[model samples]
Target: EADIYQTPRYLVIGTGKKITLECSQTMGHDKMYWYQQDPGMELHLIHYSYGVNSTEKGDLSSESTVSRIRTEHFPLTLESARPSHTSQYLCASSDNPLEQYFGPGTRLTVT
Candidate 1:
């Protein structure tokens, strides 16, 4: 099993509501990432962090933001979500040469 975890595997909310997607890892990896994906679609990198105090936006554009204060924790937050934001948020981490391991994901919907 992968070491990462994401909360509220599914969520439905109204527009303009603040929401947070939790992500954590137990592998003590310094690299963490957040990706957005539609059902059965390819993953798009939304956010990533190299280590504590080092957060960078990914190649994809996203309204959500992430933070990496602790090596094992990286959380994504949306100050106000919209229907367009509806998608699956996946969390992943890598130690060295190994490929990233993914979390189950949070399926968020804003109506």
Candidate 2:
């Protein structure tokens, strides 16, 4: 089973609402990442953190932001949700480059 976990598995809200998606890994993995995905589109790596105080923006542009103050936690925040924000957000943690543990994705919808 995956060691990663994401809270509020699903969310729905009106436009302009602020939201945070929480992801945590208990395996003590130092590498964590977040990806944005659509039902039929490709996975886009939006953010990643190598360890505490180490964060880098991925090739994909995103309105959301993430922080990694603690090695086990990487939370993503959206200042203002919009209709276009509706999508699936996936979190992952890895100890090695070849394998990763994925969390139960959070599905967000901004009506």
Candidate 3:
């Protein structure tokens, strides 16, 4: 039952607030992914890492950033939150690209 976990499942903050979405996995997967989704919309890849200290920006452009300092942790940060940044952020990990384990997801709201 190894799984990915996200903290602060729901968040509400004012514009210009700085926040970090925490994500971690117990399965020790080598590949990690971050995706952003709006309600009723498709998920967009924002960032990914192949291994520790190896990171890359994803297909969809994002203002947020991520770091892969450890095998189990992948956190996304928004320096200054904005209304346009309000969305659901998902964290996923997998040994292979075809199969990914996703976290519960962090729903963010910026006023």
Candidate 4:
């Protein structure tokens, strides 16, 4: 199993609220990524990092941001969330050709 985790398993919040989705891994991987996915859909990469102090936005445009400070931690933040931002946030990490492992995910619903 992957050593990654995400908090709140689920979240329901009002519009315009600031929220942070936590992600962490214990696999000692230097690469981590955050992907946004809706039900029965393909995941869209929104943020990723190569290692500590190295972060970058992914191919997809997103209102969320991420940071990689500690080797085992990568957290995503939304400055002001909206209904449009409601989706499942999946965290994953990989070291090489091995498949990426995903967390249970944080399902956010804005109302």
For model 2 the local lDDT of residue 24 reads 97
Model 3 segments more than 4 A misplaced: none
Clashing pairs in 3: none
TM-score of each: 0.97, 0.97, 0.96, 0.96
Clash totals for all candidate models: 0, 0, 0, 0
Per-residue lDDT tens digits for candidate 1, residues 1-111, read 988999989999999999999999999999999999998999999999989999999999999988888999999999999999999999999988669999999999999
The predicted structure with the larger lDDT, 3 or 4, is 3
Candidate 3: tens digits of C-alpha lDDT, residues 1-111: 448899989999999999999999999899999999999999999999999999999999999999999999999999999999999999999997578888999999999
lDDT of 4: 0.92
Report residue 75 deviation for candidate 1 (angstroms): 0.4
Residues 1-111, candidate 4, lDDT per residue (tens digit)? 778999979999999999999998989999999999998999999998999999999989998888888989999999999999999999999888578988989999999
> Candidate 2: where are CA atoms >4 Å away?
none
How far residue 78's Cα lies from its native spot in candidate 1, in Å, is 0.4
lDDT of each: 0.94, 0.94, 0.94, 0.92
Ten contiguous residues minimizing lDDT sum, candidate 3: 96-105
